[model samples]
Target: MRSDLSRRRFLGGALALGATATLAACGYQEDTGGSGTSQAWSYTDDRGRKLGGDRPKRIVAQVTAAAALWEFGIRPVGIFGPSKLPNGEKDPLAGPIDLGKVQSLGNVWGEFNYDRYVSLEPDLLISVMYLRDELWYVPAEQAEAVEKAAPTLGVDLAGVSMPDGIEKFRTLAKALGADVNTPRINEAKATFERAGQNFADAAKTVNGKTALLVSATKEGMWAGNAQGFPSSKQMAEAGLTFLEPKAPGDGNYWEQLSWENAGKYRSDIILLDNRHGNLQSEQLKASYPTWRQLPAVRAGNVFAWNPETPFYYEAATEQLDRLGSSLRTV
Candidate 1:
């Protein structure tokens, strides 16, 4: 059996904690200054696990979680996971996190440092759970020790529509004391709302069109199941057709295929995974003749897809708009 690594050959399947009453705040930002260190704070994660304390001020979240919180104006003190690239620049999945201000515990898979994590004296550790109750990026070997170090939280990012996933983060951001009611957040939310209808309308123009979303490795390809990912689920719900594999592989997230079988499913457009370390459409063309022969590739109907896009309204709006524009060209 193949090991279940989050990156490379293994697709990841994916958290919460503490003591106080569950906060009633939803997605909107309340007038709370977000500095409620004196007031008790509690939040129930997607796994139904609740953790709380004096509104966490020294939070440590996985890079993606940090990015989502940053969008809502709550900066985590420390972050782990794929926050930095080999180039040392911030990864797109990191959103606009100021690397200089935050400490990165690990930049690659299976690289979390226990000593570094505990040294931060974190009040809360939050990460996205791609699978039920499994916190992404927390090394399984060290999970027990890490969980004992601080209160933990997990935001479910899978098996839910994009809007629903984003709302989950939004509510967590609000509960954490983000200045969500400000004009900036309101404008962002308004723009994101408009993009939803725009995406649906654009889907109408590209009638009979289809898209295939895939992430590749030197060994093979993994075509994602639209229903398994948040963005794809939302796009499909908007009436855009995404090709699904007849048989899904690990985690029900994607179908594993050798390079020779990559053309099994053909589509009008191909949304290639654009996460750091993943091969781009151009690279795929250069590396494989099969990729070159695909109709989508020949027509250049390939687009970059950041599968782990942070749950920020503006970021989501941009993502939907870009995909919508691509759908029109098909």
Candidate 2:
């Protein structure tokens, strides 16, 4: 069986703490504080080169960047290597402006069709996830190379240490021409704030339940840590506590547990990380009859948390949306 537990950590970029709380205060600003009418939009990347001027019209987003771009009201003309849907659909954007309509720009993952992407004539292209090491693990250089083909702006949130969702959205929006100060932007921000507060309130009320956030692939299972990984954090915030090991080691790691050992943890809740294709629900039920008999599953507390949603994938924005939706039934 192919294991989904990749040895390499996925670069999810920098998450600013209390990010949602401070977003309304963040906005597009000129480095030198130029006049609003300067007609020159200037911003800098990590390398310090000035960027911005003409906003992107036809945008192409691959990976988590789509979530951030979506928040900015900048829908892409195309997407690369999209996550599958529960219904077994590819490029879920098919009905309106299907992936069929967009040109395929080969991905950094080798899944993308390079020739096709260049033919699309996009105004801007963005990449979110990190490529494997042979690909240099440098999302920025790859983006710059693509920009040589079309003005591209690449942002990989896996580690810059920026604020979480709210701050991520604000920074991304301004970069993409979306106004952080606008009423619409504020409205989106407020909606996220309310959702976050709701989770916090719920967490406080449900305080003693022991939970585990597990991502199962053919590879194995991964347990999330305390810092972020939204679902686990939000669940805790909503009153559900995780029975995380005192020494989880580092980051998200799979805790291999056989049928006999599965019940030892005695969790009050189990949040399954069901990605695009998850048939484990039934398989697990058959293999671990005791697990099915566990109080959480028996009480319908075992929930499948699909991280394929736009928000979860991007981690750039709408995290509260992801958090809200994940805890809906729990």
Candidate 3:
């Protein structure tokens, strides 16, 4: 079960000038080189860059970004991200997009096939950016090549409120021809707003109980930093008090701790990373006597969490509903 969530950790390098020239030589160009499409369309991306050209028809995007667009009736021609589960389960981040309709460039980070991507003749490339790193979800090593292949737009996953991020996606989708006024689309948005209010109301009823989000592996446990994650911040806004590490170990997103020290934090509820499965947490509890001693763990107040969950309205509603239910029981 844990196999699906084991991502390859790679150190990204700075973009090189030589790579840019090589991409240009391969016939890759920006949106400025008109492809004979309509010129009345333009979009300002999360990076504040204005991209203009005929509405992009052949779009390539990161899987999560693709998910957000799909909710608004926009679909990408190509997507890249983690592969299906070992048992061939669909990735939740894929959202409502049918995987069979799009091309999968590669599954792992830093492993995109440049030749294949270029062959697709994409008019635009979209990805989520980690603001602090100043890098898009596209591996830094492959950034230049991907950018050269088409005009690139990034959606910031940090440095903004979750609602802001979702709005950005909506704005882009509208610019790309999605009908934002459609009943279906409006209904999804309305549902999410109500879910958020429900979560907040439920949280207020819990009497200030605290929750901790964590990811566990055979190597160790990692506590999520609410300050670094938009979803966590949104949950905080909904009245959930997330535990912040006194000393974060991995940038501002996570704090590493051994199983022996996992019980140091006292949380009323535990939100475990469920992207892979819940087997890891069970194994940890069986291996370490202290692991089961956590207040949340002992009380069985554990809930599933996916840090990379899609920011679309439907997905947001589902997640908030789950959290609201847990808060009510608390």
Best by lDDT: 1
RMSD of each: 5.7, 8.1, 4.1
lDDT of 3: 0.73
**TM-score of each candidate structure, all chains considered together:** 0.87, 0.66, 0.87
lDDT of 1: 0.78
Please give the lDDT score at residue 91 for candidate 2: 39
TM-score quality measure for candidate 3:
0.87
lDDT of each: 0.78, 0.50, 0.73
lDDT of 2 by residue, 176-203 (tens): 6666676776765666556667766655
Candidate 2 weakest lDDT stretch, 10 residues: 15-24
Q: Flag regions of model 3 displaced more than 4 Å.
A: 1-38, 132-135, 277-281
Tens-place lDDT digits, model 3, residues 255-289: 77877788767898888877764345677678867
List clash counts for every candidate, in order: 5, 23, 0
lDDT of 1 by residue, 245-292 (tens): 898877777787889988999998888888866788878888899888
Candidate 2: segments with Cα more than 4 A from true spot: 1-39, 46-50, 83-101, 104-109, 129-152, 159-163, 180-185, 217-219, 226-228, 234-240, 245-264, 280-283, 293-295, 312-330
